[model samples]
Target: MLRQVQKQMSLHSILYNKISENHILKKINYVVDFSFINKLLEDSYCKNFGRPAKEPEMMCKLLFLQHLYILSDEKVIEEANLNLGYMYFLGINPEDELPDKSLLSKFRTQRLEEATLDEIITEIVRQCVEKGIIGGTSVSVDATHIEANTIRKTPERLMKHLARKIIKTYEKENNQVLEEIPEVPKYKEIEDHTEAKAVMKDYLENVISKVKKNIRKDCSESIKTKETIEKAREIIEDPKFLNQKGVRSIIDEDARVGRKSKNQEFYGYKTEFMMTADERIITSVRTADGAYVDGTYADELIEQTLKSGMKIEEVYGDKAYFRKPILNSIEEIKAKAYIPVSESVYRIDESEFSYNKDSDEWECREGNITVKKKYYKIKGKSRPDREGYKYYFEPEQCKRCPKHDECAKKSARKILQIGLNTIEFYEISQYQKTEEYLEKYKKRASIEGKNAELKRFHGLYRARGYGLLSVSMQSKLAAIAVNIKRIAAIAASKFCIFTLNIKIFSQYYKFCLN
Candidate 1:
């Protein structure tokens, strides 16, 4: 089933209510406790009022119900009013009044703050760590884009064709009869199934032209186009608004969009997350701009997570992460970067002295490099790019070489400037010529499956909310939600084992009687 019930907490609800009601405050893992969340918001002005405080235990119960049921505050309040199970879960009687929904919205804006969401995610991660859901050996890393909260568009970003339509409006005198004024304000309710964005592009362009003309006509005697615009036109020129759309919401605008593939487009900021191999628990969540290329982003993600106090033994990812920098980082950590090597390098000079096959003579492609100052040194090139890197070619050898077009470029002798680590990793990566090495490279496929699960099942493909903080909160909840589901499955399997053993006992008893 698609799990579409947004808010209905009846007795028929599959998720139970009495799951997290342990008392006595005894040596519990505070990380998963609702009280921890309460503490996060306790300092806010909402709780500092003269009104009677919600009993601490009752507050914890209400929050726990929200977490498990994935309810918005409004939904939770509604369910508590209608459902006996929900009321009972919150330590309220069948007769007690439900809490108001506005309380939560106000609380988030006035008190809870952005850090509370972050703390909730952190606590979930802490619980996963405590439960051994995360291990250092193998983590599947992937990223997705999310739309920014800004619904901004600018005249400059409009297609050249679209801009022409706007300008031509100015070329003609403005008549009282305008082309088509869209509901003039908001497009949130304007989702026409037949509407193409290209149409919106044209509409916005025309709108831009009228607005500019209005600015000119409305201009004051002092500043021409600047002094007489409305609050709306002033908004049209806000540097943040590259373009404009949507009803005025007090937050930023712009639905950042990106493509995962040909038809699989998503509107969201990209989030790169890593999941552990053993239990499929998310280790970290990283949000990237929708525009960053995946392969290049792999190294940045791996570096962040590794620095965040996790021991990473291996990284698994798809072709999007198969890059030279990613592989080199893996080698630096002595962890395997599971990526398939391209087989285009069909022939390599495997001579005895070439890069010292076994004896380490350190030969150049020509024949051998004479050791200067006991180490290969070059001017200007540094660190990973130094020595064994700046390749010096003999003019005599290169002038007649068959592959000189690619191998050397200079009319004289050519010097190839590259990081030694870069070429060395590329060469070492070539050892996958054998089936044994190819088998090791195959683990990357596992992460692709994990990416599918993270996208489809974990609610990460796109989220319901629009802000960076809101989207981040939803993504973190989703990861922990999946982890909690995994934990529940583990618990259920143990219960099944116990029931199976009992069944066996009963059968054995019946057999003895017969």
Candidate 2:
């Protein structure tokens, strides 16, 4: 059951009203209405039965303050209990009781879902759109890395730790120590990592096999024992387990090894978002493992922004978003993409050959037209030039050409792999020299500042807890807090106050001086 919390008169609230009326929280409270939170998350609670729970709006407001000031769960409650402005913002009297810190964590992990968090952002952006805060049709997309909370371990050490955990669990469940356990591998004695990994793997497999044979068949197994055995088996069966780093941590398995640059790597997750070009308000956000690509969520971000009633006319990003599918998706919505072209992916020499658009073939300087074409999909893990076409000329034509010695010296025929979007990319590369593209591309720099703000002030530089869910909630709530702050500034500048209704504002402000 949802408990409806109503503000009542109190001597402490009366004494502190005058000093807090001019506070920023008071203006924020006047500009934004948190009542939508309860209604948005109304389905999360039991409406007919059960004891009354803390007001969903109040709990969410607590979260807003937590991320707004970058305070921990326990620290935010202690600060809220002491600060009158926080109480006023939360719509609680000075003497009212607050929930414990554990409840805040529970509310974050259990009561809230990722979809609800996205809805909260959408609703806030919707308010901004209604208030004329976000009026531009241009949006910028970018991503940043967040470090994981667990300590990273090497392959040998990780395998040893997992094996020890299983052995300990089996011993605890069966209440008897194995007399003939496998001896620990002397990893230091081996100089080769591959040999050391193989030895450690063999030792772990022996431990697992020995434990399975000793289990009593007449009784059911404990959940912990079964899970540990399954995990060991899964790790053993993975062909690429030793080839990649940071796949399965003893603590956080969801995190992976991602790159900040070619020379730099990080063990954690990535947060990608879309923000309005003019107002700098984040419209949508997505979280993935550290190795996630930058522009994988462009379509979803643009769709979310459109759903919030904002028209998107132009999209801007770095070279990572210059894929054919992403460009086609943006073009489908009648929006132009201003991403820079990656020279490595779109480089082609146009002096020797010309493309025939009507025939979909290329002609060389010697009048040798392409006789055959096949779609060549790049195999393996490399992403550069993934999909393209290999244009092949007639063998006799190539062998008879004067330039055959230079173009096809060692091959039977001359073959050229042209990028799928080479022509469109060439046009975009030409457009990059114009004034319009230069001026609009300047806006992309703002997202970098926004990323720095998220990392420096809002505690998004590192994960507060393990897993993707907790970090995602942290990121979206930070966005909401910043949006509220931005709305307050815009409202004060325009001398316009925004709220759901005048009645709710008056009820909260009746005791304060004008």
Candidate 3:
């Protein structure tokens, strides 16, 4: 049954009271508002269940502590049992039994969904915003990699393992030994990497086909064999089962190969964050497979921030986000973008061409001829015209120009593709050349520090668990802990300032009255 413990002046309580008041746990307990979590998770529990569940708020605090101190589940529970500061933060007596590590894992995987986690983050941000700790006007966006928890395996080893598993399962079900399993090709036989990869893929496909044939032939003999065959079929049909690059990891199929530099490659996922520039508060976060490009998800991240009730006046990002669609999305929301233009944009200098909005024509530098607007099918397909406007210069005009050779090759016309957000792009490009843009763009540097903090301090460089969902949960929890710590620091500083002002006022009043 759910019950609240009665207040008592126990020895542990008196000792906690006598402990230093400047402890981080004491400061966090004084400032942070964790009560909202109880309401947020209220619906997750059943009124008529088998047993009264552990309080969700306490469980959330446990998770926050886990990331805040970068402790493992076992270590966190053990520390909570032994440390008075941890017990004080949890509002539990020293004798209280701490929850087991399995229960914490169950709470993370079963009780907390992505939406609930998001809600908790949003509520925390809201409180900070209300208290003027975070200004929601401008935000910087960036992404970092988190290594998955798996050991790298070669294609040959993975294929052999799969084959062996199927063979053992078949033998165990039928109570009969097979003559021999499929043999994997040796690496020495294939000299070229590409050729070897192709051979391995073909061999695996053949093995799967043979296994299916055997299953169909033996289905009538044993139900167990049929069940085994069905499970094997599901594994083979899984989209993440295998790819051209080979299996990323047998343990975590969702992870993909990611390269930070030419020399640094890892198997993991990518986490993107949008944080307020003034306070470094994380506004929104997204998790994707390692193979996803950083620029591809800017639109979604911006939308998520907007949905969380933050007014985005401006966005700052690196050149990785210098794509047409991303710039257009920012303009659609009427927010300014501080992203630097890519070299491709500079190649087509807009200064050389004058656009006529009324006639939909672009006049070249010579002003004697105009480039005509045209729409061509992209990639030789007929449907869904391209997103931007393509302008083609007259071949005759280009041929006569002094810079013809520099601008275009012989028998080729000069063409420029301008997106519908061309005006916005031009504005951004011009602004990038100004002092204001440079100063504003500096804010993007802070997100890099936040990424470093997440990796270096909170253990985000490598994921704590396998699978995309588990890693995503880890990212969110880390973000929450960072925000909570930031809030606590801000609160402590404000309190110090307030106390100093009060003391000064009291001393001044005493002198004036005397």
Candidate 4:
């Protein structure tokens, strides 16, 4: 039942006074406003049905405490019971009973959806902005992988195990045993794992076909058998059903294989963050399957930040986000992009030729090259226009030049072909050489520190639950915990400064009176 009434206590309760003056939790309680939480999550609950539910605000506070202290659900409840500060933070009286660990799990998985969690995060950020903790003018974006809660296994092994499971289910459902159950093929003698995987795939396919045919012919069939067949078919249809390190995990199908470096790989999901530069507070977060490239969601992240009412004047990222589409999206929002140019841009050295923007011409030491716009055509039909500039050097001028061999490697005319990105690339390259751009670009490093803080302090390096939805919930809560901690620290600092100034003024006034 909802705890709507505050418990009455003695006027001079020792526990109440002690918790009221606690530094960290006290500051957090004052700085964070949880009154809006219940209203925001009002739609998640039924107004007139079922037994009375736990207060949504208190449940959310419990989740915040869980991530803030890096405690499991059971551990968090235990700590809250033992510590007066935690109890006070949650507005629970000393004698009030705590909810069960199972209830906490249900709240996250069943009550709170991803969008609701996102709204909670947005509200926290809005409060921070109102308190002057976040500048909201610039944000840095980056992604990190959280290890999924699953064991890594080869696709061939996983597939064989799945097939065996299906067969077992079919056998258990019907009261009859199969005449022959296909044995898992042993590839121990095969030195090449790839070739062994292919062999197992063929064997499993044959076995699955036989089992399906047998099940279809049977007069008595159960729902379990039908579901098993459907799952088996899904496995067979997957393109990487039999390759090594292809299928992510049997336990958690949503997680995928992500590469951390050229030599290191992990099975998990990627958590992307857009954090404001001033306070290092995360403005928006998106979780994706680990296999997704970091640059693929750059536009979406920026859009989400904008939708959260954070006015972005500039955005910063690494070379991975230096794509044409991403750059254009940032430009469309009229925000300056501080992303570094890709290494490919360095190869196009424009120092040898001077560009005249008005004439759209490139002037060399001895010859002038004019640009011609080119379009694409396929099968004698004009396709959608793909605009690119083709700048060709005078063949006669190049033949007479002293650096002809260095300039032109082929017998054909010296032509440089580039799309519209060439202009953006040149601009970024020039901007990168200036001190202003370098100073602004340095802010992008703060997001790396935020990522490290999450992994090291909040236990975000490894997911606490399986599946994408559970992992995403964990991530959002971790971000909220981090923001709350930051806000508390900032508020405490200001309080200290104000107290010191008041004491100094009182001392000065006493001296003047004396």
User: Candidate 4 lDDT, tens digit per residue, 203-255?
Assistant: 77777777778877886666787787677667657776554434546688788
Point out where model 2 deviates above 4 Å: 9-12, 19-22, 216-220, 349-416, 496-514
Give Cα-based local distance difference scores for all models: 0.52, 0.83, 0.76, 0.78
Rank the models by lDDT, top first.
2, 4, 3, 1
Q: Quote each prediction's TM-score.
A: 0.58, 0.85, 0.85, 0.90
- List model 2 lDDT by residue over 1-514, tens digit each: 8865565667777856565444768877765677888988878899979998888888999999999999999999999999888888888888888999999989988888888889888888887788677788999999999999987776777788888998899888878786688899988789999999889988888888777777655264656877998987786677756876546587888888889999999989999999987788899999998989888988899889888999999898998888878889899999988899886668666677777767877788888999888988776565554777899988888878888888865555588777778866766777897998899899889889889988898888999888888788878888888777777776676553444456668877985754
Superposed by TM-score, candidate 4 places the C-alpha of residue 54 at a distance from the truth, in angstroms, of 1.7
Model 1 TM-score? 0.58
What lDDT tens digits, residue by residue, belong to model 1 across residues 272-319? 777766556565665545555665556655664554356778777755
* Residue pairs in collision within model 2: none
lDDT of 3: 0.76
- Stretches of candidate 1 off by over 4 Å are 1-33, 45-49, 53-73, 79-97, 132-136, 147-254, 257-267, 292-311, 318-388, 394-417, 431-459, 494-514
Best by lDDT: 2
Off by over 4 Å in 4: 1-14, 20-22, 242-246, 344-359, 363-386, 507-514
Candidate 2 similarity to native, TM-score: 0.85
Where in model 3 is the C-alpha error above 4 Å? 1-11, 173-176, 213-246, 261-264, 295-300, 303-309, 328-334, 344-379, 382-384, 387-411, 414-423
Ranking by TM-score: 4, 2, 3, 1
